[model samples]
Target: MNRSLSIIMPALNMEHLVGEAIATTTRALQRAGLSDYEIIVLVNTSRDGSHDRTDEVVLDLAKKDSHIRPIINHHFKPFGLTYWQGVDLAQKENVMFIPSDDETIEDSMVGIFKDIGQVDLVVPYTVNKKARSFKRRFVSRAFVILCNTLFGLRLRYYNGTCVVPTKLIRKVPMRSGSFAYMVQVLVLLIKSGARYVEVPMGIKPTSATASFKIKSVIEAIHALARLFWDIHIKGVRIKIPF
Candidate 1:
């Protein structure tokens, strides 16, 4: 059976929250009258016993619904690799990336399903900014400003969860191993003249441990520099057939 949407959830040390995240996402899809969908949980290597617990939970969920696929990666890879691997495994035409601890707002899910094939990309921005920490909020705002300035596109946010066409996303060559890969994907898509529709969504505050780290920040800066040089200096742009 062909599915309409595939949700790629990357998990690492989210034992306490992943179960609820999966359940809430499932419930949201059902409430939106969307049954033709699959949820792929990519469990990365975790030393905190989260891997075992997530394996158990996802197996139990999969028994109830065959659409839930849990993939365990013994060798830990970067977030981008895990996410794109799940995308490669997706059997649906439309793909969405949702972190294991964060679930998309029900209203936003419904809205995306309503406009599934109407747009090339459905970009969602956080509406409840006060719910996030000051540091997180500030970093997110700064990242958005930086991306817009560098890419010459006026976007409200660059790192939020979005619903994108699988084929179009696959067309964009991804080289970043860091979290900034999402930014690169969005920039390439925008540069390719991909049609976008923004939707307001609510995101829960990420935990400090799961949020930003010094290593990630440095990697992000490196990724941004590479993207700037390739796109602006070398005139590198993805050519989309759509």
Candidate 2:
């Protein structure tokens, strides 16, 4: 069957919250006049018992709603590997990536995609409600500017849930070091010219998210390095806002 929508959830140790996330998506789609859709949730290798419980819920949903399919990836932990894997397996024209324990959409988000005609990617803008710290917002804003300046990405928020067209995504080269997979996709897709649109949405960091100070610094350095590398490859001067 030709699916119209495929929502990919890259899950790891989100057993406590995965069920609620999946249920919310299903309801949202239903309210959007979309009863026929596929939900692909990839359960990556996790240290907690989240896998077994999530597997059960996914299978149970799949039984009633044939549109739901649970993809189990035991080889890799929760990172870009599992994320890319989920994207690769998505078979619908419209693909939405929702983090297992992170943010989701509003009623307007449903209307946003329903209104999107031919855009390659639709980025949902994030409103952080969980972490009130200014440090998180600063890191996120700096990276967004760097990506746009270096890779020519016009997205307002790249980390939030994004709705993408499968055909357009297939044209972009997607190969990066396991540790730097997301940066690779961002670089290749923008350099090759992908048309993207942006929308606004709420965001909140889950308690399980790696929001530690050390991790934040490491992530910033890695993103900066990737930005410079892309600039070097293209031989262009990035006009950074800083």
Candidate 3:
């Protein structure tokens, strides 16, 4: 089995941390003995002065490292849309996107990368739930329960950065441009009979919780509704054995 992977790092107004994120991702891949990989750093349009700076950092890093591929977006898009764009641009056997917010620990990434060729999907779950605030934990738990209940499937988590086969993911249509996009993809793919393995991963503590924002919350609800309609009403599903 080919262990080649395409790592997508999506950054939105994260100029201060994007560079380190890329460095950390590179180190994790190397430590996992994965040299055949590409890091596609996506710098989405930002509200502040960080957009151009972030793009510059990615471009500079790309010059020194051939594995770094930079994608600079001029218009602002939701996180899911940006991530899906990067997925389409990947040229490797497997694909996964890590947030540029520096919340992913290097060791956690190495754990996922090391299991690259062993499974069709590497699903990572946070082991350190205390790293997040009580409010976030509550929301995250509720979200997971809702997804499991609605889909009639049991999954510990859905939003974590997951390593999935590029061809398999490409076969599923991207319906949500919001954070729930991952949820939609996972449900559809799993229903289509994709094999997956769950692994424990650590998350760095952060005070930021943008998913609670009003716009993000609305987008999430809309995404869930659309996903339910597509699956239950429209009968949207990926073909198995792709």
Candidate 4:
């Protein structure tokens, strides 16, 4: 079968989450009635020996199902950003980005590929079923609000798994941005006038475990600065339906 969907996961020290992610994505795809999809596990080099574990998982899964491909995302200084590079490495017409740590969708959610229609991208909104702390919720909501109001691009969600077309994902090669690749992706798509649909995810884990540390703040600012420079300062305007 001419498989159209490609699942791209950029793993970084996700030993704990890798197994579940791979299992969930693959099983979900099969349950959705398309079992020929490819699952690419791109793990950045880490000291945690994730490389070995990844190899084992990918090889074993590949033996059972020929759709799983594993590769080490090697670099001297890891960018701490995989959402962009990971999908680009995929060899499929459609690319889905599911964070290794958070995000667990159902087989019905997997069917989004069939239901995607003419939309260029599909970004699912997360429902945090677990009662996370108040501080994390506040920050998450605040960030969404700031990005929407300040940028005028009301993207329903930002950080969870986002399924984008291969063409759109390829256009966004550079990982230089203020937040992570996703924020820049939002800005770029808004700049490119890409149409999108927001699917409400069933239950998402609170990545908002503790209060934001100083380091995380710095990374956020840097990611945002890069976006501003690329869009406004650099005079590259990618428009969206505000």
Candidate 5:
């Protein structure tokens, strides 16, 4: 049977929340009358033993429901690499990247799924910015502003969860191995003339225990510089049907 959508969930040490994330995603898909979808959980290496637990849980869920597919990466890689691996393995035309700990977007999943074929990409922006930390909120706003100014596109948000055509994604030359990869992919897609639609979605507050390091921000900045060079200076854009 052909699958309509493939949800790629990249998890590091999300043992406490991955189960609920999967449950919410699966339930939303099913509720939307979308039985032809697959949830691919790509578990990265973790020192907290969360990877092992995630494996167990995903295996059990996969046993009960064949739509749940889990891939365990033996070596630790950044979120972007894990996400790219899932994209390569996806069997659907439409692909979505959702974090393992995110649950606030469940209510909007059905509507997003319904809009799958209407556009080449579906970009969802968080409706609740107050849920984020001040630093996070500030950095996110600056990043989006910078991207829009540099790319000449007016996108409300660049880091939020988005759905894109698998073919378009596959054609783009993606190189970022950090968290900035999502932004890089979006920018490339837009430059490739992929039509997109933005929707408002709710976002949960950041977990108190989650790690938000300055090092990640530095890495994202570096990746953004490289992306700008490639897109603006080098004139890199994939040729895709709009």
Candidate 6:
């Protein structure tokens, strides 16, 4: 199948890494034989000392490659909101987000594109957990277990960048505005009986572990609680249109 993808790259203050992230993603897409693809580099507001270098990098890179489209958000938005902003502008058969931190390697991205049309969703789990610290791993595992218990589905990981049909994902109501957005998306898509395949991929070690930060964790927890309330309490279910 000839697959076209809209790669949504969320960049916060990753001026030093966003360029490489776009480069690797472009190379990976080419290697995967996907001639039709676009990279949406959505640069969110940054609090770092640098003066909007992230947006500068994205725009500079976009000038080099027409496949790269840059969107600079003046105000800060959480992960989920930033992600959906890209999705709303995506025009492709499938969509997935790649972080601008450049943690996910080139080959891992190729692995995802390899399974493009095989299923409705291409879920990836980290094969190399040692790349992360013990604390990060423990928190990840516990979160996965919690999601499984609450949703009654056994899955390896919920946070890995998963490829999904553009239409399908846009159809599902987004309830989480924090880092737990991916978890909410996965659970709702799976519960709605979307065909999916899990692939194990390796990630490069990175010192940037922002998701596990106290503020991020608290925000994620609050978002997760809201999701649980909508699903278990209010009985919200996605009606995926084929």
1-242 in candidate 2: lDDT tens per residue?
Answer: 22377788877766777777877777777776776568888877654533457666666767887777898765655365566666778877767777666356546457555644445556667755445356666766776786677656566766666665666555444333233454554455554455566677765555443444565457556755755665566443312111
lDDT of 5 by residue, 114-167 (tens): 777888889998788888778778877887898888778899998777998888
TM-score of each: 0.90, 0.76, 0.93, 0.79, 0.91, 0.92
**Whole-model Cα lDDT of every candidate shown, in order:** 0.79, 0.62, 0.86, 0.65, 0.81, 0.84
Please list the Cα RMSD from the true structure of every candidate, rounded to 1 decimal place: 2.5, 5.5, 1.8, 3.9, 2.4, 2.0
The regions of model 6 sitting more than 4 angstroms off are 47-52, 211-215
- What is the Cα-based lDDT of residue 83 in candidate 2? 63
Please give the lDDT score at residue 170 for candidate 2: 52
Candidate 1 regions with alpha-carbon error over 4 angstroms:
1-3, 47-52, 205-210
Model 4 weakest lDDT span, ten residues long:
75-84
Candidate 6 has an lDDT of 0.84
lDDT agreement of model 2 with the native: 0.62
TM-score-wise, the better of 1 and 2 is 1
* Top candidate (lDDT): 3
Best by TM-score: 3
Of 3 and 6, the candidate ahead on lDDT is: 3
lDDT of 3 by residue, 1-242 (tens): 86999988887777788888888888998899999999898888865534558888888889999998998888787788888888889999999988887889999999999999887789999999999999989999999999998888889999998998888888877557777988988988887788889999898898787457888889888888888888888988877563
- The TM-score between candidate 4 and the true structure equals 0.79
Give the alpha carbon lDDT tens digit for every residue of 1-242 in model 4: 23477877766666677777777776777676665468777767664533546555555666876787777655423333555555657777777766565356665367565545457777877675355567766887788887776566877777656677676666764574234567777678756778777776765444536447677678877777677777777766543333
For all candidates, the clash counts are 0, 0, 0, 11, 0, 0
Clashing pairs in 6: none
